[model samples]
Target: YSLSVAYQPSDDLNLYGRYATGYRSGGFNGEMFGSNPFFEEKVNSWELGVKSNLLDGRVRANASVYGYVWEDIQTAKIETDNGTATSGLVNAGEADRWGGELELMGAVSDSMVVGFNYSYINGDFEEFPDLCGVDPTIPCLDGTANAVRSNSPGNQYSAFTDITLARLGNGEISAFINVAYSEATPENALWSNLVANDVFPRENPAQIMDQRTLVDAQIAWRDIAIGDGMLTVTLWGKNLLDDDYPNYSINFGALNFITEQYGDPATYGVDFTYEF
Candidate 1:
């Protein structure tokens, strides 16, 4: 395990940093491990940040940036046998990731508080070849020089806002709404090996995956007695609009391809619990 810490010297001016490392396991694909073997992957990540409370503790803000490098990134290797993806995880050579985040908070009044957050991320295989084309008719991944994996996205961003209200006597009721946004991203960094003879329509979505904006809301009621015990419940819903956008794409080379992706469908659920 990686050991690191963050230190804040003051309430008005705060600073912090951290260092961490993680491992990715190596594994064989049941589809093709019989003929091919694969290897494992690893990564090292580091980050730093600063936070501040301004306007006499009414306003608060924080910002942070991070970087990471991976050794022997596990990659999927495909073979000509039925064009099925069967190779195990192989060292993907190397890869890296870096990003930053900013957030702000404010106390509008004694009864209400508001906050906002934003984040951006950029990741690249750095060494993967762009053998995949831009058209929609590309057949299965060509075993040719064009064949590559590591389709991670290059740019991603998100924004969110939240609000909280004071509670009531026996039980408190607070409502919140949060909206988030993200830039389009590549489905994968490597050429798909789904079907051997299949030429993927496009290595990724015909274009960058579509950007998306999601809105969610929640209402929580807590600290109430139910019968002989205390009980609480939350009514929550996500993607309330049920916006239809592509969440992912598949390109098996020319043999098979799915250009459009199906995003999450809208749903609402309730959580209820009682303590004795």
Candidate 2:
């Protein structure tokens, strides 16, 4: 079920609110773990937001705050027994989340524009208990609510600015830059702990992906006369700073080593197109 409301107090401003409920169907983890499946998960969400244009249409902004609760969340893990490993899913208990976002765009002039966006979220498991390992004597089951939810980033931000430099030969030349940042994130319990202080002293004691920033740039010429059509040309570079950040990492306890994947390095490309 869901509900929503909207109000416009002036020609330049609008307010809105919403409440919604959703469900996610759980399923088996992998063929290695047959016949067993995780339970479904449900969530209830609420949001309040506003949109406005200020400074005589030169600036526009949108912002929202939201909260949600998750029930019977499905979680997955891998287990090994006697040199064979299998993946399985289970119904972890409840969790709650809250977040907010703001987006702003401004026209510094008719020839230049800038935009920015930011988001923050905090989520955690409220109740969960599961086996820590294959050994029954290890006493892995414990009732605890302190586990940090997987894949939940606490903060993220991005911004972009574009400017039209000049007009020549019936075409406009523009340049733009984009930047993005993300806070460190918690790692999965499975691989994160295998290479902790007890094992790999060089590795992080708490499994986490370090904060990273990425930048991109582009220059383009548009509406150039080409025979009977218009032509556009663009030169672009991605990951311009050549940041070498880990895209993924895992510590295999059984193997006694950690593996990591790195993001793409700086790359450049050019594109040309003709429009009829």
Candidate 3:
């Protein structure tokens, strides 16, 4: 269920708020035999935000903040038995999350526009009691510790711009560029290698993903008339900087080894489209 309200205090400004409830059905962990089925999960969330236009709509800005309380949160983990490992999910208890975002865009000229966006988020386990250590031989049932939510980055930032470069025979040439960054975060929610220092044991370094920055861009020519239709051609590139970063990993401590998968390298391509 959800409820939302909005108000416009002026011709160029507006404010809004929302409240919502969410639910997820319970399910069994097919990978682990004799494991009890997890219970359903629920959450309550809310948000408040505002939007504004300045300089006669040439510049625009928006911001928002939100929070949520989650119960019986379902989390994924690796289950080991008799030297074998299987992936499965479990209900890890409660969590509290909050975040906000800011966006700004401006028309610097009739032919060019620039924009920037930033977002931040945080999540903490409020009642997780089944955390596990890096030792695959040790099961979660053997310990009680809190761990950060998996894949939840605390901050992200991006900036992008679009520009009209020129006017050619019945067509327009334009270009766009975007740069983005993400903060490092844990890849697994339950395994933190806490057996060593229980108080402040280091996380499984192999399971913590590294922060990364990526850039993508494209240039295109559009609106060339072709048999009563329009044609567009574009050239694009992704991960322009060719950043090297590990996106996923698994730690097999008993074997004294770990495995990792990396993000993609720089790549380029061309696209063609026609409309009638």
Give a tens-digit lDDT track for model 2, residues 1-276. 999999999999999999999999977666656777788899999999999999998999999999999898776554444445455677778888899999999999999999999999987777776435434455554434345665667889999999999989799999999999988886663221221122221212335777889999999999999789999999999999998887676655564556678888999999999998
**Candidate 3 RMSD computed on C-alpha atoms after optimal superposition onto the true structure:** 4.3
TM-score of every candidate: 0.74, 0.88, 0.88
Write candidate 3's Cα lDDT for 1-276 as tens digits: 999999999999999999999999998867544566888999999999999999999999999999999998887655455556566667878889999999999999999999999999987788875554556565554223446667878999999999999999889999999999999987777653333323332334338888999999999999999998999999999999999988988775543567789999999999999999
lDDT of 1 by residue, 1-276 (tens): 675676767768978777888886665556545544555667788989998999999989889999898777665443334644334455555666788888888888765677777776666555442343334466434333342223333344444444445576767777777776766665554553433333432443233466677788888787787788878788999999887777766554544544566778787989897888
The lDDT for every candidate, in the order shown, is: 0.64, 0.78, 0.82
Worst 10 residues of 3 by lDDT: 192-201
What is the model-wide C-alpha lDDT for candidate 1? 0.64
Clashing pairs for predicted structure model 2, backbone only: none
Regions of model 2 farther than 4 Å from truth: 132-138, 141-146, 189-206
